[model samples]
Target: MSALPRHVSPARLPEVRWLRSSYSTGANNCVETARPSAGPWAGLVAVRDSKDPAGPALLFSPASWTRFADRIDRL
Candidate 1:
């Protein structure tokens, strides 16, 4: 199994700075992303709902996140 966690609490990530997409509107209906700078989450991209800042943040490797973004771009 991968050593990276599937999800984490945003509250525990003090070193991460979440950012939403520039395309997002004032409604805040999009997601936010961050790169964990330390701990087990380091080097992984963290994703969470903009509406749920305190909710669980999903983790993804840089490559995986890029591939996912590529797929979305194709749509």
Candidate 2:
């Protein structure tokens, strides 16, 4: 359980396949998510602004993502 990096350059995670929620409108103004398929980032979730594809990504564990979503759902 080492501390995960808070930010990563999107270029450094080329293998990560970013996806946006289906709920996102055609304006493409939503956030995107990626699950690194290889390397040390494998199995962790990556999030970045869709408007800035090359921007830094925020990493989150599966459990942490679920909790955050749950909290949002309750709001």
Candidate 3:
């Protein structure tokens, strides 16, 4: 199996409003997303598992996040 990428812990990351995707209908497997207040990643998006809020957050650049959204939309 391929190794997964490492991410920073959500507890260490700045606090922000974590919004659930509209597509998630109170599901346990939903993803939660938030934006950091300050850092090299300010304005960047961070995503994590809703079931594991304190777990690692996957950071993404604005452009990268847009591309990811587009890909998901296409799917």
Candidate 4:
């Protein structure tokens, strides 16, 4: 198995649609996520700071992202 690159420039992503949790207040304090359906990132989940839409993004496999989120939710 190969690991996905830790980060990618959002600018390199083609047509990414970033989404934040509805639970997020409007303060830009939460992370945003997007699932890339094409390009090198196809099928990977991308995470970035809501306050910096143009910043670098961290890529995670769907399962890993889900696990991370579930753990955070339990806290």
Candidate 5:
């Protein structure tokens, strides 16, 4: 696996294009995801709390993310 920061401040990843689930409502109670478009962070996914757009974000490798989503789907 490629080395990646375990966590990063959202403000430091300004190039990320954050997205929330379509099922999310106006309460802003959901997690958001974004892919780093360029630089070392590219190809990995960044996830953050929708209610805390400027807060910390978790980083995940693409394969790791796919496995996580797959497990969630199976549940």
Candidate 6:
């Protein structure tokens, strides 16, 4: 995996509607994700901590997203 930019503050990032996985139980240790609704960031998926909304987010390409989901399903 590649490292994320260290200087970026998640709080300063654009507001996004983070959604938790439906499979997640009541635990707060779940991931939240959001995709840009419009503009240049559109189609880019942003993932971050559900427990820390202001935490750093990891950006993934569409293909990478699919591969990630597949890997998760196997776990």
* Runs off by more than 4 Å, candidate 2: none
| Candidate 1 wrong stretches, greater than 4 Å | none
Question: What digit string (tens of lDDT, one per residue) describes model 6 on residues 1-75?
Answer: 444343334654566688899988887789888886665455777788788777687777778788999998899
lDDT of 1: 0.90
True lDDT of residue 40, candidate 6:
45
Against the reference, the lDDT scores of all candidates come to: 0.90, 0.90, 0.79, 0.91, 0.87, 0.72
TM-score of decoy 2 = 0.93
Candidate 5: deviation at residue 37, Å?
A: 1.0
Which residue runs does candidate 3 get wrong by more than 4 Å? 1-6
* TM-score of each prediction: 0.91, 0.93, 0.81, 0.93, 0.85, 0.75
Please provide, for model 5 over 1-75, each residue's C-alpha lDDT reduced to its tens digit, 9 standing for 90 to 100.
556778998777876788888889999999999998887787789999998888899999888988998998799
Q: Which candidate, 3 or 4, would have the higher lDDT against the true structure? A: 4
Model 1 over residues 1-75: C-alpha lDDT tens digits?
A: 467777888887886888999999989799999998898778889999999898999999999999999999999
Candidate 4 per-residue C-alpha lDDT over 4-44 given as tens digits, one digit per residue, 9 for 90 to 100: 78899988887989889999998999999999998878999
- TM-score-better candidate, 4 vs 6: 4
User: Considering lDDT, where higher is better, how would the candidates rank from best to worst?
Assistant: 4, 2, 1, 5, 3, 6
Error of 2 at 9 (Å): 0.4
Estimate the lDDT of model 4. Answer: 0.91
Alpha-carbon deviation at 58 in model 3, angstroms: 0.3
Q: Say what the RMSD of model 6 is.
A: 3.6
Worst ten in a row by lDDT for model 3? 1-10
RMSD of each: 1.4, 0.9, 4.9, 0.9, 1.5, 3.6
